[model samples]
Target: MAASGISFRVAQAVGVGGALWLSGNIAALSLISIPALVRSQTEDSVPTSILSRQWKYTFEAGKSQNPPIAVATATSFCYLAWSVRAGTQLGRLVPRNSIALYCIAAILTIGIVPFTIIAMTPTNSRLIAIAEQKRDAGGSVKPNDEPVEVLMKKWMFLNGIRSFLPLLAGATALVAVLG
Candidate 1:
């Protein structure tokens, strides 16, 4: 019983803490980093190479960092859910609602990976290709695609949507905890 409580606390800490941290990181990029970069230039046109490098650096970093956090968070939440599932530890003591909420958190937290692959991949690929093409040209190369700002704006929108997942996951877990 004491061991179960200790493990439960650990899982709750990781699940809730990781969800909030992931959401905060993603939200900062969508709300602060991307917009600041997009608005930095005073000219009518923004530079593709600059945007590309910036996007590439941040995207790569996030791609490496966020998925692991998401997985850990979801795994923690899964532990919580499994603890309360049938024929499992603490199943009799913990309520059914928390199990359901933890399951939801696990889904929403881990869902960011597939969301990025499916929903954000097109824009990411386009940006990467444009960046490679234009970085050496020093923005003198006329883009064959849409304006870099337009594409970036689209990316910001998509990223904003993505940021909500972990936030929602965190909120769900919080609700479960409060209950």
Candidate 2:
């Protein structure tokens, strides 16, 4: 079935919007939020439990929200690719390579899931474990400051890398559309 003009436009918008939204949020989390939290911890001598709890909350919130957006964005990109390939515009001048670009965008967007699971799960698991341990101990155990900071630093670095996937996806899709 051919995509109506309006349908194609909407799907493009969604794909573009969702990819950017995912990228921006992850960027903010990695660049702004987590850094600020860590800085606060260092400046204020915040307790382990409190610090871990804050990080935990932030991590949990993102975990809940980001995956779905990635999936949705990928779906939209795939649809756009199919629409273009299926000849949505009879006389429109979509390049032959646009389909490949759209497929690349969709792959990049959706690939964040397994990327996170495979690359980030160990760090995430350790951080969560620290938070849980501190919480379970009634927020009394301080543990080693170095370990917590080390983990946080590692997580921030990994997260920063992860943010780029969606960014690349958005750029790829936008370029394909504009061409």
Candidate 3:
């Protein structure tokens, strides 16, 4: 019984550690994206100057790289947390559905919104490149596709959602922890 208690406590620690690591990674992603978000928010259109062009490319490159890293962090964190819980006495004490709910909430409020923004942002080379590829494939130079206003609007809306999600998740996590 004593050994079981020790194991359970260790497992709980692992779960909490996973949560902490995930949270930290999310925070880091948010910080990394902040400048790009600001640039997107402030600029009316993609810039034309050399420096602005360089910055835009830099931002795009960063956006592409950040999402995969962030997703990996979230996946590893969730896997660790879930695995730890599965081994614990609390696994029996806490309803499985409740754990599922927590995981869903975590993924929704933490993993999805922010990552989606990074993935979809106009300055993200992947999105722009895809747009370009489609345009080139269609063999059109007309401004009919990916208008600046449309891209800006989409980026703004998604980034706004991404900006607010971390706050929501933090509050939810606090409630879960305190209650």
Candidate 4:
């Protein structure tokens, strides 16, 4: 019983930490990176060239960071899942809100990957294609196929939503711990 309690506490800590980490990363991307890109687009540098360069760097950074984020999120989800199962088995020993918190955290943490796939992947692909085209053409391409600014705005909006999920999850989980 004590062991189970310890496990629950550890899981809650790790899960909250992971959720916060994800939230912070998304917030940074939305607040810092996207805004910087938008500002860069307005500069004297050709918009396509600035976008292409930024996008390439962003893609590379994402590729490098993705694995660790995935691992941390997966770990958090697994622990939260275990907590849910244990809470169910323990019945009255665990607060109902605690179980709900674990479930919410698990769902939100796990959901991010699929959300990215469904919500963000298409826009990302389109942006990457445009960036690549611009780069290949030696920054001469106009990105004439689509409105780059509109796409960037849309991406930023979606990213704000993405950032919110983990933030909510982390906050809920923290409340569960304190309450």
Over the full model, what C-alpha lDDT does candidate 2 score relative to the true structure? 0.86
lDDT of 1 at 57: 87
Which of the two, 1 or 4, has more lDDT? 1
The CA lDDT of each predicted structure is 0.85, 0.86, 0.47, 0.71
Candidate 3 per-residue C-alpha lDDT over 1-179 given as tens digits, one digit per residue, 9 for 90 to 100: 57755754454344344444544544443455444634663575433232234444544664575455445434533543364376565466555454554455356445554576556543454335534433344444334345443444455455555645434544443343333
lDDT tens readout by residue for model 4, 1-179? 68877887777777788788878887787788877787777775546756766866775686577547745764765665556555365445556666677667667766767888899998888877777763455546664566666777778788789888878878877876776
- Of the two candidates 2 and 3, the one with more favorable lDDT, higher being better, is 2
Task: Write the residue-wise lDDT of candidate 2 on 1-179 in tens digits.
Answer: 24466787888899999999999999898899888878887998887777777889999999999999999999999988887785456225588888889999999998788889999999998888878873444557556545777788889999999999999999999999888
Order the candidates by lDDT, highest first — what do you get? Answer: 2, 1, 4, 3
Residue 34 CA displacement from its true place in model 1, Å:
0.5
Candidate 3 residue 41 C-alpha distance from true site, Å: 12
Model 4: number of backbone collisions: 0
Could you give candidate 1's per-residue lDDT for residues 15-82 as a string of tens digits? 99999999999888889988877886435355567767777888789889898899999999999998
**Per-prediction TM-score to the true structure, in the order listed:** 0.91, 0.91, 0.45, 0.81
Model 3, residue 161: C-alpha shift (Å): 1.6
Best by lDDT: 2
TM-score attained by model 4: 0.81
How does model 1 fare in lDDT?
Answer: 0.85
